[model samples]
Target: MSLLSKADEAKLKGQLQDAVISCTERCLYSSAKWAAELLNSFPETDDDGSETDVDSAMSDPPPPQTPTPSSKDPIEARLEARETQKYLLAKTFFDCREFDRCAAIFLPDSLPKTSFLVTPSPASKSKPHGKSKIKLGTPTKPALSAAVVKGLSQKALFLSLYAKYIAGERRMNEDSEMILGPQDGITTNKELPGISAILEEWFSGLANSGRKPQGWLEYLYGLVLAKGKNEKQALEYFIQSVNCCPYNWGAWQELSTLFSTIEELHQVTPQLPQNIMGFVFQIYASQELYQSANQVHNSLAQILDIFPGSAFLQTQRALLYYHSKAYEDAEQIFSELLVANPHRIDAMDCYSNVLYVLENRPKLAFLAQLAMTTDKFRPETCCVVGNYYSSKSEHEKAVIYFRRALTLDRTFLSAWTLMGHEFIEMKNTHAAIESYRRAVDVNRKDYRAWYGLGQAYEVLEMHSYAIFYYQRAAALRPYDPKMWHALGACFGKVGKVANGIRAYKRALVAGSFYDNNVGSSFGSGEVSGLGGGVLDPEVLFNIALLYERVNNMGECAAYMELVLAQEEGPDYDESVGDMAGGVGVTPTTSKARLWLAKWEYMRGMYQRSMELANELCQDGVEVEDAKALIRDIRARIESQKGDSSVA
Candidate 1:
């Protein structure tokens, strides 16, 4: 029983003839029966050893064994040999990295013969009448060459150990034994890498390797590449990986993230699942990647054409429409979704928001109520209800709802501010002030709250407090003329006249006009040199008269002009006429004319002034005093004429 085939022996001797090949004394002749079985499966050789019956030889059963007398039977001996040969061939294929071929060998020829073992029925001597006796051949021992047995055993051991390694059960010691054992048949020096390590190395190599790999290896490689810093490289790898392995979720996830990070999401549109369309919409919505989002939306529509009953896809389409601001489409879809699933919270919120934005207040209110019924604790629903009440001027109801919203979300600043506004509208100044204070406490930099607080204090006549808030508001918004004017008025109320004037100057600098309600006007209680009161016609006239006394002719004329502009025809006559008569002028006469005459005379309009004085003299106005004043004006005019001539 030779341990090696004659060919294998000759090859070994030839290798030893070359001094470069050396084997230690421990190197025993381990048969390569498994290697021979694999080689035989390749094809049969011709007389010249060229493959002649290639396909047929590969399909042939294992070689026949020399039967011995001890064997059970000829059939049993041949069957045993065939089974041994099949095991050896499987082992050899596995060692050669031909896993597909190894798997194929294990497949049964037919369904019923698929079991690994074959059972034989017992022979019976009973026969029909007149049947002759039949004798069975004696069983014989299967004469397997020692070399083939050793090789087959080694191969079987290697395969068993490899299976354990692949199943993640082989210990490091077991792997080391398989690699370093004398009977270990694999030529590679390294222990068979663990499945995970092999997978990792294969992934790394495919990711860095220019050539493309296929199957799960390609998909895993793409995942590794996608995580790498080089995005372009990752993109290329991901495309290849997904193409190779479409079922790999890792590849899909990495592709999604990669496209999202670079914002080149169009690259992933074709591959995105309908289930993740909503996620895709969210990414584009956040980044404002409209074109890519639209493509994805279109893709979803295509998928829906194929799978129209997909509820999840319909929801995603609705969200896309919402993001695109196609409110009509969104409303339609959400309405459908709500009808289908009555308790859809997100759909309710989205539909409500759309209505709110569209200014369909009643519809928004209805939706908000429904949403509240669905989830009483939802703050957004409460906020929507508050907005509805606020729009209707139901300040009390608005306040209650806004407060409820605050209870749900303590940090809701807009709710707090809206609550303050409602209190203000309700004329609850103290409560308004407290609400604004709370808003400011929540957000110290809220300029609107500071302004609101200032207005509340102003309304309460708390001048100093008002000034404090007004200054804060002004500091936050220096360009606001209203704040400047309010600060000026507050200062004036507290008798800080100089400060008040400065504040007014600031208002003017900020482009405030001093007409009626703004800047140093008696109108609207913003008067200089006067107490808080409505503008009085007589007092204004007196102020004009005082301006005349102080030689401020321009100011005096301005005041008179304002009076004339306000006083209309006969009413002006009656008012001015009564005042003049009290000062000794006739009733029904125009006193502003007389004042104008005096002003004209002082302004060197002597001829015009004399004409006015003469008219008054002829009317018997102010009787004795009018005539004397007219004579004095006439004489003074003549003296001015003489001086002009001399000049």
Candidate 2:
């Protein structure tokens, strides 16, 4: 397509380089003291030193040889100016939403490989390495110098690629919710438009040139591969990226997304540079998986000694508490964060969640209004608004706001999960499942979405499917009692008694360890309609019920006794169990007493049954059943006495 052939283009680029070098050398020649510095920078020559004359020397009169104002290298100064100009122009185009123009300024997709960005230098072909020779041809490296190239690579590369990616997403502003994310989910990234083809060809060109990608390019490549769902290759490139430039949080974020399980994370974590940034990545990963609460707590504690003022580290701490169901602790941190940095909106969505859970509607509404006033269109602000509506039971409006957040950024994982929650509240199980699936698609490490899908499936009575989903969530948050508890319930519903018992036991151990190591996540006898079950009296009662299901009366009675004993204290009365905030057995007390009484009666312990039934009767719980039980016991005793007298 070019008028010149490859040979002519190479010769032209060489001539241009010579002019730039000659102009640079002539400027130094004006300062005789600097003339010697230009010798090493000149082009290679023949052995006899009879070489091509400098292009400007062949002219009759020389152009002005004045040194630059700063006494800087004229060529280098020009490159700096050009770099800045191009970057500012590209940034302006991006701000104006001219995404294609913004990207083309750096990485033009419409043209052939014959652009100003890349020029093959004949001198660089077939470089020697020991006795071997490595041929590097047609490199993707730009003609810019090391310093100029580094400056441009920092901002232009990421921004330009990000622009291209957004364009390739093929989004239309008017697209409906159903169109943005279908029933299957937003798995359309692999179907990116022509930009993807162009990028692929360019990447191939880099590979063919025998030059590995730069750190930033590797990061971009990983992002593209991740978007296309080539996770394994994406992971390798991400690792390479961090090795090349370990301080880039952007690369770490993309790298962390590929890990769906803690095992995968653990395996890859050692390979990552264990610098300060890598430690931050570990904390971030812990928050995402919700598994290593202890690591999040202790590791963040140590790191905060170095960066105590970092709001991000503080939010990770709050999130750790949130995942552990320690809402009060989490709320305190969030409140402190907002007070210290009033303009911060990074974790407002999480703060809103804590408020919503605590049912502090006034604070929630205030937060919503504050965020809306600050930046109403941010995904976090939209989520806060959505939570506000959700707290008010405005399910439809909440969903609309959540959808708006997703429309702005579909990769906003919280929006997808929260929208699914709204759908679940509206009792639209199918829609909820779709939303949750989309969340998982965006980041499989988001255990909340997996758990939400499980809950939705559970609501639909699809116990088998619910178990599968719950297991996925539990794997991410292995220490989370709620996830294990959900899995146990699903197993029970599916008639997998042994698996149910094992899952319930995991819930019990997880809860105990959590309380011991991470503080009491859920306080004693506390029941949250929104929370997953823990190793409280409720779990004990479930274990008892399951044991009774399998006809294991001994274990059933043992667990029932444990359930009631937790409520028993020196100040507690038998009648205090059902009282709110009581030291007694609490809301599940009556159920446990009824089961224990029935078990006693079955085991011929009629007197124990009578005492328990009498307590239930006095407590005004199971009154009718208690009366019938008392009558039957009394009648049986009279009949037994008659038989004894007859004998």
TM-score top scorer: 2
User: Tens-digit lDDT track for model 1 on 156-221?
Assistant: 322433333322222322333421144322222122333224335444544443433333344433
The global Cα lDDT (0 to 1) of model 2 is: 0.69
TM-score of each: 0.29, 0.73
Best by lDDT: 2
Position 125, candidate 2: lDDT: 50
How do the residues 1-647 of candidate 2 rate in per-residue lDDT, one tens digit apiece? 11344455344334333434432322212222222222222233243254545574644433334332222334435533666778678777876778778777876543333444565467545553443232332223223233322334333555676666665554433233452444224234422434344455556555544433446567667777776678899899899888865544567778878777767889998788876557778888877777545656888887665445667778889988888777888999999999887777888998998888778899999899999988888999999999999988899999999988887777788899888888888899998888898888878877878888888888889888889999988887776777888888888887898888898888877675444223222222232221122336777788888988899988989999877765653334456454222235355878788778877877778899999889889878787888888888888889989999999
Candidate 1: Cα lDDT at 570: 23
**Model 2 clash pairs?**
none
lDDT of each: 0.50, 0.69
Residue 271, candidate 1: C-alpha displacement in angstroms: 40
